[model samples]
Target chain A: MLRFIDARCMLGERCIIREGDPNTKEAILELMDRCHIEKAIVYHAMARESELPAGNMALIGETAGDDRFIRQWCALPSYFGEYMSAEDFFDAMKQHHVTSMRLLPKTCGYSLRPHSIGKLMDLAAQCHMPVFIDLGTELTTDESYDLCKMYPEVDLVFGNSGYRENRRLGPILEQCPNFYLGTGNYVAHCGIKLFCEYYGAERLIFDTGLPTGSATAAVSLIGYAEISDEEKALIAHGNIERLLGEVRL
Target chain B: MDFRELVYGQKPFEGVFVFDVHGHIGFEQGSQLGPNDGESMVHTMDRMGVDGICVSFSPGIRGAWKRGNDQTKDTCKRLPGRVFGYAVPNPFHAECDLTPYFEEDLGFRGVKIHGNIQGETPENDPRYAHAFELANRLKLPVLFHAWMPYEVDRAADVASRYPDLNVIIGHGGLTFARDRAVAACKRYDNVFCDTAISSAPDGSIEWLVDKVGVEKVLYGSDMSFFDCIHTLGKLALAKLSDTDKEKILGLNAKKIFDL
Candidate 1:
């Protein structure tokens, strides 16, 4: 029996313009149930609080109650002071087994500290935590390339890098070897075919960014695009397995 | 396949004009909308079944320019049979003597105005009045970028002034009220409502047809920015006949834009 997986699924809504919408968890699960996604790492949108690690921990706590999925630590830098002395960052990383910090410097209005970034990288090195940064912000996709280059070991998943002209990202794909992309919204854009062909298909992963019915729709984009099933299987699950290594589940 | 065939399964979809009404051309390369190159829009129009459109953008043209007309010259040259591009003018660009450009250069049949996207209050801006006057003189319609609780009053004010000018209030369905568009259309003969992004739970097409005549309504799917097929699916559940659907789908736009 073979099981497929979506490594980059977020537990929260991806749209920044409007709020009060439902998060991506139920939507992701429903889309996954419809499209068959197993073993997704979900995050929370309720991280506006001062103590974001606590907010993230609360999400982890909520999902700890559920059997179908697992929650990732969504760290807000404002909450970093509460728990982030490199030691505490590792403690939370170990406790929550956080694979990513959903970075939002423009929306969160914070700096990625030299001290924090180094220690965050150390924890990522120690615990293998990858950070998912939404490139939908004011930061250009080329800037996303810079961020990925700065911390090459810590896997950076670029989301909403640009809506259609995502092909501009082709140069970055050629330059940055370790960087990966969150595939939901990206696949819908017309240039996705060339992107998969140019960048190794393994460098891409599927995401719903769900609650916008994006996950389910995105599945079809990957399913129907000119790419082969072998490449899609890598994007859908194999690449995630390679990144995270063997886990108990 | 041709535009009619792409949408309606055949050509000679008699007297049908499927106007996208809302479109963007020339978004910068590697940006969200592909590139600002010559070939982008022609490729988009062919794939989307958009026969004609009145386009405006968040960018592409500088603030104090007729970005709409700037985009029009290229779209017409590229997809001559498939598109009739609209000349977009904002209050900032002071070109009162646009008749020559309208007739000679751009050959635009209509005008597109985006108020909210540019972060302006069109009601207070007198520069738009100049645009309205030019449209009236040319016997051309104006399809305005609008939404209720934001740009409704501006739409009504312009529509009331030029009774013959076909003023299309782009997104008029109030998520709250049923009679708002009806009351506005009743107030002005030129004003007509487009059932756009307001294709939500409350503002259904049946409610719009009940408020305004079927002739007054036009269908538009905000593609690239929205899922076109899914949006078309939403209207499939509306309480209207196949003819009503056909008219809304293409015929009404044909009549409205004179395609």
Candidate 2:
């Protein structure tokens, strides 16, 4: 079985949920076990939905004894003393063993421009911690290119892509070497093969937008992709391992 | 079928009958799709062990209808049993007649109504009545792009009107309209749903099967627009019994399409 490290997952309760969704942490773990995903880079729902600081702290409490979850925290620009300073946030992350950060520009009512997040991006670049965000919610497909250009040194991994993003993503893939995409919902036919052919597997990150996203479907896309075994390894776990391995904090 | 082992081994689903009920070919005007041609789709199917797929020319629902359908006809002709065609009707074209497509054994198994892209026309709009009537006469399946609650209702209305023809609500089972889709499946005998969406979570298929028996569910990959492998794997590893898995994967479609 190909081992997977989910780059995107959430804990805590969500506002809108369906009957069969894996909304709870235990349900998410059951899905991870079934899908052979060994570890997931996880965030808390409260951070994104209700409160950022409490949600981040809640994530620490939730995944306390569980080594299966690689900790990730939601970030704010902290312009109005709403959150910790960039230095203090990174210090807290290092203390808490958090290796990555997630951005919620639209959800938090902030901008992605360097002017708004320059300090956080600078700190992220210094530590080599990958910054994660969603495609449609945090920003538009067109703005991904701009995000990559603005934070050239910091690696940006965008998740929650649908099938209809290739026309917009093609140019971004070509121009932005720092931009990586989450493969959870990027289910376009032969999409993985075509992406591997053009951009190579290094830029593709394996993720299941878990609790809401399908871990079964996400793993199947990579396992059944018409690419070589080496490419599959890279997408399934190799690239993310490499990305997280480089984290200084 | 040892579906889990097959997925772990990354092997094709040999020895199992797998047929996709929702698919699209040709180009998408709104976005770029990967390998949308018949040959490319077949190559993916070959890798995944899918026995057959029914596709509609995506562009036909919006642009010139005849050319779009001719494209489907040509693809179905070239591919034979492996590829089947869905005859699409242009709602704007008053003279549109899908009867000719069904007259021949050109592998046209059903009708596709994607009214949302066709000026947001209702699924049971009067313009689609003609095609629905023909499908009813032939006892064929009519697949509707019903992704919303209202769209599911419209499709259910069609099922009420045409008791003979099966109405497969595409992308409705695991979407926001799932409750509506389940209600319709319970309310109408001919109403069914396909697993064609990209964003539904795990256990969704199991839930659908629980709400409306596995018989009402069919495997639909939305290939070319989305890969078949993901949805296929989802069914294989779903919490349902192997028998239910088989039924949803292909057996159900086999009975519906008369394959």
Candidate 3:
């Protein structure tokens, strides 16, 4: 069996579409089992639409018992003490055992500029935690590139961006070694194969964009990609495992 | 075969014939991404293990309808059996004539109508009715690019009017509109859905199959616009029985297109 560690998944109720199962821990796990995903790094779906503290706490509470799930919290600007300060957020992450973080700046109402997220980025860099930003959501590709440039030590993982953005992403990948791409929406023809060849497998991580996206499509994109097994395994689990292992929490 | 076996190049479905019902030839404006020509299309099909494809011309959807149809016909003629043509008719074009192409000599399998692409909406347009009428008269399936519920409903209304005209809702009405597409499929026997979008939100395909039998669904890559392997992978990884998978992958297309 090919074990997979899905780096992107959400847990909570989605307000827009009521077709699929509720984005609960049990439901996510059931989906994982059905899709043959062994482990997953999860965030709360509420984080995208709700306040950061409430959403993050719900995420921590809901995913308490499952060690298979690597907890991911939502990051927000520290303006007016709405969210934690840089040092405080880092401490909170350590205390809560949160290994990774995602940003929804647009939905959460914040900016990706240094003035807003610089402290968080610095702390994340110091602690070796990976911060995920979806292109066209929390940040555009250029903004993400700027963030990577500012904090070269922080590992920036881009997700939810489709294959068409590859031309835009090419320069970012070439310039920033600390950058990574989540393979949830990388559906370009020979995209995985080319990414593996050009950027090495370590820069790519397996993700399903589950609940919102297809776990089957995610698995198939990597599994059917004309790449070697070694590369596949690395993208499937090793890269994410290594990133999680480096988390000081 | 298991997912692992299929992904590992086992060719578990060696004998099964796969037909891509929705695909495109030619190029899109301002985007140079794809197997635009016949040679590249064949190369991509070979790589993805697709036995055949029913293709439309992109230029026809934009403008220059006749030239694009001629190009598609020529490509299909050059690669007989492997390549099939979908005559894309610009309903807005002053000289939109599809009669000759539907003849046996042309060997075009179906007609493609893009609602939003041609600077017009497909619902309640007189040209669309005429085109649908032409397709109904010729007893050919009409693939309609329906990205919303209203479009699917409109197509369904037309299909209801012309019971023999098989109208396929492309991309399964995309993400937000899939349920509506499924509803349309259930309501109308002549309505079918194709999976061609970039993403396959969880349980969407399964829901389609469960709501409307596997025979109402067809495998479509929307290739050149999208990757064939991606759609193939989506179908391959769907939690379906091999028999159902076979039907959705190609058997349904074969029956619809008579390939």
Candidate 4:
């Protein structure tokens, strides 16, 4: 069985959940076990949906003793005094053992430009921590290109990719080497194989986008893809393990 | 078939009768796609052990009616049993006639009505009445790209109008319009939902099955647009019985498409 480490997952309850979605942490774990996902790099629902600081702290409390969940905190540009400064946030992250960061620029009402998020980007660059963000909701494909260019040092993993993004994604994938894609919703027919042909498998990260995302479908995409087993391993777990392993903080 | 084992083992479902109801072929004008041709789809199917797939010319839904359908016909002709055709109807073209594809067993299983792409045409628009009439007469399945609640309602209207034909509301099962799709399935015997869409949550399918019984749900990959493996895996590992999984994967589609 191919081991999986879900790169994009949310912890805690969120508003507007459907009937049978894995909303609770326990439910998410059950799905993880079912899908054979050993670890999931997760952030807090409250951080993305409502409060960033409180939700980020809540994530630390939620995954306290569980090594299965590699913790990721929601990041906000500290231009305003709304949250902790970039330095303090990194300090807190190191203090709490949160290895990665998730950006909610659209939801948090922050700019992705160098001026707004430069300090955080610099800190991330200094540490080589992978920055996580959603494609459609947090930013557009064009903006993702700009983000990769803006912070070339920080590896950006964009999730929530639809099947129709190949046209926009092709140029970006060719241009941005730092850009990595989450395999949760990028279910284009033979997309994984074609992507492996053009772009190497090291760029694709295995993710379920759980709670709102489908772990079952996500695993099946990589599992049944017409790609080589080595490529499958790179996408399923190898790539994510390498990315998380590179975090200096 | 030990569906869960297949998923966990990362093995193709060789023994199970897998047939996809919703599919698209030909290059998409709006976005880039992975190998949107008949042979490429068949190659993927072979790798995944999918028995058959029903596809429509994606560009045909919006562009020239004759050429688009001709493309589908050509593809169907190229791959006989593995690739089935869905004759698309262009709402703008008044002289549209889908009878020729149906008249001959050109591997055309059903009629595809993607009204949303054909200039936002309503699913139950009068222009589609011809195709609907043909499907109604032949007791064929008419697949509609109904993603919204309004679209689902319009499809439900078509189901009500032509009770003989089966209306498969593509992508409506897991979209925001799921409740509407479920309601339609409950109300109308002929109206059914396809498990398409790339962004649906895991349990949404189970909820859909719970709301509208397993018989009402058919496995739709939206293949060539989306990969069939994910949806197939979803059904396999779904918190449902093997019989139900078998039904959604191909059994229901087999009966509906009369394969």
DockQ of each: 0.10, 0.89, 0.44, 0.88
Q: For every candidate, how close is chain A to the native chain A in TM-score?
A: 0.82, 0.99, 0.95, 0.98
Query: Model 2 chain A — which ten-residue stretch has the worst lDDT?
Result: A14-23
lDDT of 3 by residue, B225-257 (tens): 666777777677666788888888898888778
Write model 2 residue lDDT over A104-197, tens digit each, in one string: 9999999888889999999999999999999998899999999999999999999998889988999999999999999998999989998999
Task: Judge candidate 2 at residue B87 and give its lDDT.
Answer: 96
Error in Å for residue B25 of model 3: 2.5
Which stretches of candidate 4 lie above 4 Å from their native place?
A: none
Worst 10 residues of 3 chain A by lDDT: A16-25
Docking class of 4: high
lDDT of all predictions: 0.57, 0.93, 0.79, 0.91
The better-scoring model by DockQ among 1 and 2 is 2
Q: What digit string (tens of lDDT, one per residue) describes model 2 on residues B1-259?
A: 7888888888899998999999999988888888899998998899888999999999888899999999999999999999999999999999899999999799999999999999999999999999999999999999999999999999999999999999999999889899999999999989999999988889899999999998999999999898999899898889988888889989999987979
Separate clash counts for every candidate: 3, 0, 1, 0
Q: Residues B1-259, candidate 1: write the lDDT tens digits.
A: 1221222221222344456655555553334543333355444444444455545443533353545455556666665655556665655545534455576745366777776644564642676677778887766778766665446667777777776678776666423333566677767777777665512431256667766777777776444443333234334334466677667766776775666
Q: Best-fitting candidate, measured by TM-score? A: 2
Per-candidate alpha-carbon RMSD to the true structure: 7.0, 0.9, 2.5, 1.2
* Alpha-carbon TM-score of each model against the true structure: 0.66, 0.99, 0.92, 0.98
Query: For model 4, what is the error of residue A125's alpha carbon versus the real structure, in angstroms, after optimal superposition?
Result: 1.2
Q: In candidate 2 chain B, what residue range of length 10 has the lowest lDDT sum?
A: B1-10
Candidate of highest DockQ: 2
